[model samples]
Target: MELQQMRYVVAVAETNSFTRAAERCMVVQSALSHQIARLERELGARLFERTSRRVRLTPAGAAFLPAARQCLDAAERAAAEVAAAVGEVRGRLNVGLIPTVAAVDIPSALRDFRRAYPNVRIGLRVGASEELVEQVREGAVEVAFLGLPTTSRPHGVAAHELAHDRLVAVVAPGHPLAGETAVDLHRLSFEVFVDLPAGTAGRVQSDLAFSAAGLSRDVAFEVTNADFLARLVGQGLGIAMLPAAYVRQLSGVTTIEVTDAPARVEYVIWSRAGRTPAATAFLALLDVPAT
Candidate 1:
């Protein structure tokens, strides 16, 4: 089958409307129909089943859809690879970042990337680590900076460890633990904790740590933002377990080292599937070895 025909099939399958697919392909409805019909005849099966209200893919079409999309993606990647070979980086590069990424200087990295590849388009998004990982896996975001567990790795993605920051306990200056150089995990079980909402990287690690210590603290406040959690800790609202990189610089909090704490490891991850030239160029700027 012709490449254009595969493109037409994928467009129709995605839009599920012949007229809309025609518009997307920039071809008349009749030509699109004729080519699809010819493709069906050659393949000896109908790709789509028609209805008055909607168009649906047949079983055979369902089986063929993913392969068709993969072919299209492979073709585009091949073309992009050739362009990249000639030192051209000019396309949209969607990058994802976790809400708490203080250890890495992302702004400086982006500024340098723009200086090197001015033509490349950049899109930045901040999200929870789990959310960002999902976006990267689905190709919605081309690359992501995430806080992954030291022992755990996300499946179906390539990850490079960029930096690691220790998880430390932060308390108000007048709090009982403020004067301590280091505190054990179990020692904080009676204290009220200010923590990230459930499903965040910080929250996940904190939960694991508490569970490992066979202890659970009172989560008096749950905030989605790390800065807000730090603020709460600083105001004497509650003690919090947070990254040392973030809590160390906060004005109103005293950071106490957490013995046996899990390291908040920063990872740069991307889909294992082929990436666009723009994404590759942007990744090179970070100096991370491809995994």
Candidate 2:
């Protein structure tokens, strides 16, 4: 089958609609459909189950999708290598970021990268650290900024540690623990806790620490936004443990130490399978060491 047909198959699987895939691929619907049909005939397997209501990948299609995507990635990487040989760095760069970790002067870095590579197009997708890592693996994003646990190394991706900061307890100024220089997590075990949602890096670190100390907390409020969680703490709704950098300057809240807390480490993660030119340029700006 042709490479274009494989692309059509992948696009249709991703969008779940042949028409939408055609739009994305910049091809007419009939031509796209015709090529996919030819591909299926050649392979002697049905790639998709198509109905007027929706398009779904068949077992065969599901099995083939990952390989198809890898083929496309390989092709793109080959092209990028050629462009690099000529000293050109012009392509789309999709970036994933966690809002809290984005406290790192990313805007200034992006501005400088753009000035150096004016022809590169940039797109940013914001999500929790866990979600951003998955997007990078799925090819939905080329690179990402994430908060990672100091003890764990992410599998199947390359990571560069940017900075490290300790987690601290945040509470309203009038709260009972407000005056303490350091708060033992177990002391707040019975108190209401405002926490990041499950699967986020911060939440993972907090849960592990509590579990290791044999402390079970009452997580009454679950939020993805660090700032909003801080506000909840300020209102005396609950106490929260977050990165020091996030809640340090917020009014109406007091930041205290979480004794022996694991440091929250910020990292920029990307796939090792291929490096786009724009990604290379941005990584250089971040001063990433060769891996």
**Pairing residues by index, what is the TM-score of model 1?**
0.71
How well does each candidate superpose onto the true structure, as a TM-score? Answer: 0.71, 0.80
> Which ranges in model 2 have alpha carbons more than 4 Å from their true place?
121-142, 155-157, 172-182, 198-200, 211-214, 225-228, 231-236, 248-254, 257-261, 271-274
The residue pairs found clashing in candidate 2 are none
Please identify model 1 stretches exceeding 4 Å from their true place.
1-85
Prediction 1 global C-alpha lDDT: 0.84
lDDT of 1 by residue, 1-291 (tens): 987889989999989999999999999999999999999999999999999999999999999888887787667667667778887776667889876787578889889999988877789998888888888887778999888777666667888887788888889999999999999888888899998888667788888888887887899899987788888888899998888886655788898898878787888888898668878777877777655
- lDDT for 274 (candidate 1): 64
lDDT score, residue 144, model 1? 90
lDDT of the candidates, in the order given: 0.84, 0.85
Local accuracy of candidate 2 as per-residue lDDT tens digits, 108-224: 888998899887788999888878888888777988988877876556788888888888888899999888999787787878999989767779898888888888888999997
